[model samples]
Target: MADFVKGLFGGQQPAKVAIPGDDDFADYAGAPEPTPAAISSYTDAAHLAQPTGALTARPYTAWYRVWERTSPEDFKLEMYILPFLFVLILVHVWGTRANRSKAKAWSKAHAPLLQQEFAQVGFREGEATSDDILREKKADEYSTYATGRQNVAFIDFKITLIKRFNPFMLLGEYLIPLFFESIPAPAERVEATAYVFDGNEAKHAPQYGSGDAKKVSNSSFDGFVFAIVHKDIMKRMREDRYDISLTTTRDHAKLPVWTAVMSESAEITDMMLTPELIKAIHDAGDSFEALIVTDQPIDQPKTLDDTKPKKRINLSLKLESTYTATLPLFQLFLRLPDHLATAAHFRPEALRRIKQTRDEQISKIRKLDDDEKAEERKVAADKQKRELRDQKLGRLSAEEQRKFLEKERERDSKKKMKRSTVKG
Candidate 1:
């Protein structure tokens, strides 16, 4: 007890630690090295300690591997992502169906009213047409409008009940809901040739086709112009927020009746909608109305050389302008009584004169085309002749070759002139 107390207080302690020369350390040195058989057994035991199910698997399958490694959080995230996408797809499809239904209902209600209007104007519905018919009509309208011919005073109205959507393009709509909303809306287009009529039904009988075909061509010659624009355009015009311009053609012979912006409130009378004016509309190219909303007056200072200031002058008061053409004016012309009145002044001689001029212009165009082609052929022939002359010139002097080429050119020019005069 006394010795233990002394050791606790930093006195001499008992020798429990082993030194290097001790019996315990010498006994570990006498132990033999492991034999080859023992080493092999140890290695096999280590290999056996690893999992057998991992190496000799139940099956080589992705499902098993994923099942083993997939975390709870990963599974939860996948559940969230899938439902989100599914809901988005459902919303898009539902919206599209609703739009289509709405458009169909709108068309059903409006078509009857439109048909009645056409009937009042002596335009009978010829036939129900398909997409093919629409394409052909569009092509024909383009050609007639471009050429200012082959068009007659018949109104063609088309209503598309439903518009189809592209699946892939529609998927992108979700990225921008407001801007990319797809609506299978009903749409309508009306095309008519405004012409002059002398009111002689027999004399101005349909010249193009007969029956259903006749209705498709120059059947109606009531001498009134009509245009029912797109709904969007009508809305813009109603609001007085559309771009409109009226400019003459490059030749300055034709004047535009209307351009981009059309108004139902234009004060122009039906008498103004003449055949000549309608022809101008057919010939006018696309143009925009530029409006200067407001302009301020300012003072200008005049200077005299470097000596002194001369005088202060008042600049001209600037003007603010806005341009628009209204549909009411056009719509008025479509009325039956107004139409008949407008046609009262038109003479059959006027129609004959217009057609004659158109025919003569077309003939000139054909002749010009032929002359251009002939000139191309002559140029090619001249090139070949020059090649042959070059080969022959190897035996002649420079002066002789030059003279021969000059004579050849003169002969070709004379021949071209003779041909042109004969054709003319």
Candidate 2:
């Protein structure tokens, strides 16, 4: 087309020009082709078969390799087994702990008794006042917290054993709370409060604790339970007043010296008074002037009426009628069974409740005693009656009532006839 265009222009076809070194067609003709580098890569593929760098396995295979990584000839069995064994042991320990916790939870599912028990032991949870300071101190001294904020304090309890020239102080007032062996809290305050045992339930049972068995003390002829209480009660003893004298019952007789009481306790439960203490009481005695009480000058109620009138002078030791008997009173009751203490310790309401239960037990025992006595009395009476009745009809069983009746009728008839003849 270019030559034809040139001929029409009268220029004839321009000569075709060829470059000196130019090829009109190259092999493959403009199609893309691989270079030598590509061919070499295919030929060099053999090198890729050998692992690169560390010659490491792929991740999954590497992880699986660890399970059987070592040969039996080189691997120590302990190394392989111990790690797994440790894991199993840890799991077992955790399981056991969990099971124990569950069991404890199940066991305590019904436990809501602490507050009630605190009330039982005379822990006053109510609002306390200055008058209660002594009580609070005593509670602080004696009360135990089982756990958390809960407290445990014993109530005032007393047992009256004997009727004598009444001793001024009861044993219960002097009884102290026992020292807890390993109490976890600190004692901020300590005081002793008067404890009186209600005797309404005194006839029931003695307070025989089942906590642990103890040896009987030969000196006191006391029971195992008494020993437990002895150590605790002895700690509460307060000495008599400075002015109180230990006067001798007999003139010039050697006084019973107060000796240190040897109670069976590693802690050395102290008896505050012995014969020596009595001597001290006497030696320290000072006469107190009696206050002259005038009724016209006094006996008026100031603001509130007190049931009892106050005197100008009151004795240091108060003697309330039927209030306290003495230490020996408790010793007397200590000889009784364990339930008596328990019976004595109960509150009036609680005592009433316990009475039904105790009565059931008492009823059985009482019947045995009553029945045996009744049987003996009946037998003796029957013999005595037979001797008297021998003059009347002679001895006979209850089954011979008809014969006795006939004999009685014959006698009555003879007597009536004689009386009728006398009248005529």
Clashes of each: 4, 14
lDDT of 2 at 282: 39
Every model: Cα RMSD to truth: 21.7, 31.4
lDDT of 1 by residue, 1-424 (tens): 9988885676764535555568767656544467675456447765778787778767666776886777788788789999988876776676556544443443343344333444222222352212112222221121111111122233333322212233444444344455633432223222332332233233444543355443432222322112222333333332342111111111112334343222111222233445643443443222112111101111211211211111111101111121112122223323433334333244556335434533454566567668888999999999999898778978778899888879989999999999999999
Error of 2 at 193 (Å): 11
Which residue ranges in model 1 land beyond 4 Å of their true spot?
A: 1-68, 75-84, 114-269, 272-371, 374-378, 390-424
Q: Write the per-residue lDDT of candidate 2 for residues 1-424, one digit (tens) a residue.
A: 9878776675643444555456665433444456575455455666667668547755555555865676766768778899988876676566445433332332132122323323222233443321221212221122212111111112232111111112222222233223453221221111112111222122222322233213311111111111211122222321221111111111112222321232222121222123442343333222111111111112222222321221111111111222122222222222222222232232455335334433444565567668888999999999998778775554566658677888889999999999999999
Q: Rate the local accuracy (lDDT) of all candidates.
A: 0.37, 0.31
- Quick one: RMSD of model 1? 21.7
- TM-score per prediction, in order, is 0.33, 0.18
How far in Å is the alpha carbon of 159 misplaced in model 2? 16
Q: How close is candidate 2 to the true structure, as a TM-score?
A: 0.18
For residue 43, model 2's alpha carbon misses the true position, in angstroms, by: 99
What is the lDDT for 88 in model 1? 69
Summed over model 2, clashes come to 14
